[model samples]
Structures are given as C-alpha cells and as structure tokens.
Target: MESLKNNFATKTAILVDGGFYRRRAQAVFGDQTAEERAAELANYCMRHLNFHGESSNLYRIFYYDCAPSSKRVYHPFLKKQVDLGKSDLFEWTTLFFNELKKKRKFALRLGKLAEEQAHYTLRPQIVKKLCNGSIQFSDLQEDDFCLQIDQKGVDMKIGLDIASMAYKHQVDQIVLISGDSDFVSAAKLAQREGIDFVLDPLGAPIKPDLFEHIDGLRTCNKAYTAHTQK
Candidate 1:
C-alpha cells in the first residue's frame, strides 16, 4: 500500500491541436517567432504539471498538425498563379515544426493538407458585406480571399493516440489543448478506462455539452493565469 501511495502522483500526457493552439496563441499572446512559440508550448505544457501537483510527471506532448500545402493555386482576383511554398507562412510553419522536433519528450504527429481541394475563399467579413449588399462583387480585392484547405488525419491521429494511451495505461491523466469538441468520443473512452481527462481550451469558451466529458477544466496560458490569480 505504501508503494502504491508513493506512486500516486499523476503521470500526464499532453495533446495539442496545433492549428487551434496557433490561432489562440496569436490572439491571446500575440505573435512570436517559431523558436519562441515552440518554447512557449513547452513551458505551457509544464505549467499543467504544476497544476496537477508538484509530484506529477510529464509523460510526453503530442502535437498534431498538417504540413502546409506547397501547391500553386491560381487567384481569380490577382489573375496569377501563386506558389504557396514561397510564402512566409509556409516558411514559418516549417521552422516551427523543426523547433518542436528539438524539444525533449515532444512528438510531432503530422497529417496532410488536402492539396487538391485547396482554393481561395472570401473572408467572412467580406462574405457578410457581399450578402448584405454593402459591397459589390466589383469592389473585391485579392486580399479579401484566403486559401482554404482541409486538414486530413489530424483528428484521427489524436483520437487514436488517446485511446491507445488509455488502454495501455501509459499515463494516469491526459490534458488536451484544443477548443474543438470532436474529441468528445475519445475523451469519453479515456474516462471509461479510468484515465483522468482534462481540457485546456486556452481560455476559449467551450460548448456546455463538453463539460460533462472532462474531469476538469484548466487553462495554462499566461493571460488566463494572471486573470484568475487576480
């Protein structure tokens, strides 16, 4: 019994939805370089350990994201083909992934961007304006459209990993860093297997239904932490 008590500290595995994290980080923490972002991610995951308890140990951090599409797509407004591989975003993402690879106990799970379906779509605001007749189609500019691409295999990878970890007892707890509710099934499975499932939405509001699936709600971001402390 003493041996079991001694090992009672939680073993936690962190799973990050890379796209959701990047968007939230930019909104809450502002922009940072690839190296800085990678460091921030590592620090953020470590914060979860402290939250659990001083005795808690980190198992690993799994980051799921799709590689940026490098395909050239023709822009109707620009009337030209743009090579996405030459864009700053592509370069930044590449650097970011490389930086993540260097972090200890970090695993990069890469999915694929649906290149064939990639195309430019109007921004939401622009679409709204057009629909409301506040702006005419002739007033549109190239900047109004952004590339749209479907991410493949990222969610599946996250779910499979969660289920695998739960069944294998790789960790006593799982902390998922994502705002999407698509993980509900996996979270439920983990809980059924006696794994503690926690969600860190980085301060984003989650659906009320999501509350039932998680063992706890916690956000480790600097802004959220500061707000809570006050």
Candidate 2:
C-alpha cells in the first residue's frame, strides 16, 4: 500500500474520454465540484507517480472529445424525429440496423455512451446498395465524420496529441487516465517501440491486459483522496 501510494508522483500524461470522464467525475462529485475534481485528478497523478527520469515534460492528462458542431449537437433530437415509432432502430442504440452492419469500436463506444445518456440514438444512415444488397458505410469512413461532438471536439484532439507526443517521443512514459480500450492499439505501438506505457484510470485500478502489457500501471481511486481539489 505504501509503495503503491508513492508511485503516483511521476511524469505522467493522462488521456481522458471527455464525455465518459466528465460524466464519471460528475457522478462521483456532483456538478458543483466538477472542475475542482478535474484539477485534483491532475494533481493526484503528479503526487502518486514516481516520474523521476529523463522526460521533464509530463503530459499530466490529455482529454479527448469530438469537435462540436451545432449539427452534431442536434443530431440526437433530429434522429429521434426520424426514428419516431420505428422498432427496427436497433433497440436502445441510435445505430440503425444498417449502421451496425458496418462496425467500428469507436463508433460503438460513442453510440453506446450516447444511448446511456438517453439522448436518442445518433447512428448515421447508410446508402442501401442495389447490387446484391450491401450498405455503404459513410459513418465508418476513416476521415473522421461522426467525430463532430456534443461535448464538442475533445476526444479527437486528445488522440492527435497522443499521436504527436508518441511520434515526437514527448514523454518518458505516459499515464493514461482512461480505460476506453480504443487506446489499446496506440499503447501497444508505444510498447513495441520501447516507449514505457502506463494507465491511471480514475475510478478503478489499471486494466488487466494493460497491466500485463504496459510497463507501469498505477491504480487511481477517488476515495483514497478526497475528490475535492485544493
């Protein structure tokens, strides 16, 4: 316990999912103390991690969210308008049967997160193909379309920042504050190239696969220290 507690003070950068993270934070501390909690989460990482090495620049935490647009913001309500009384709208998810036909984990996470909030499903429409029945997956386009945000553009920017740092060898090691498995590929790439990777997911301990693969995995708990930031 003593050694574990001490590991938090280190050179670390946190990768956070803006929607899930903030919502989780809010769930933990309520709306009034949200910013305080965010700031405290940063401080908590610094205090606990033993980041005493060559990399002077620690990322602290990189928060990610999609870029926000009014269209994206209103996408849910508009989708609800379209899905009225429709049973095959893929049940609880905003994803149409056509949409889920072409799957991406990122899309699934975002769509499920959206449905969790009950804002109506925001799955994109596919152009039903005439040739032997296939759906053209515009949402799965690699060019970052569904990335338009309601929480706004936090996640994409966070991802780009991580990529930039990894490309530039920015930090000695990174301590991601998220558990969104979307980052697993990036983490693996970092480790394959000999960069140290770590995780400090806020509400729980480091994930088991991450623990096995990452060089360092620190556990973060809102309860250990007061969620109230000084």
Clashes of each: 0, 24
lDDT of each: 0.90, 0.47
Root-mean-square deviation of every model: 2.7, 14.1
Candidate 1 lDDT, 1-230, residue by residue in tens: 97786667889999999999999999988999999999999998888887834357899999999988789998878989999999999999999999999999999999999999888889999999999999999999888999989999999999999999999999999999998989999999999999989898899888877777888888876557632211
lDDT of 1 at 119: 87
* Model 2 agreement with the true structure over 1-230: per-residue lDDT tens digits: 96665554334455556556555666665663333554544555454443333233455444444322222122332332233234231232222222332422112222122322333332344223423356443433332223322343345555566666677876656666665666766777777756667665555544466556666554445373332121
- Candidate 2 regions exceeding 4 Å error are 1-11, 33-35, 48-60, 67-160, 205-208, 222-230
Residue 131, model 1: lDDT of 99
* Per-prediction TM-score: 0.92, 0.48
Clashing pairs in 1: none
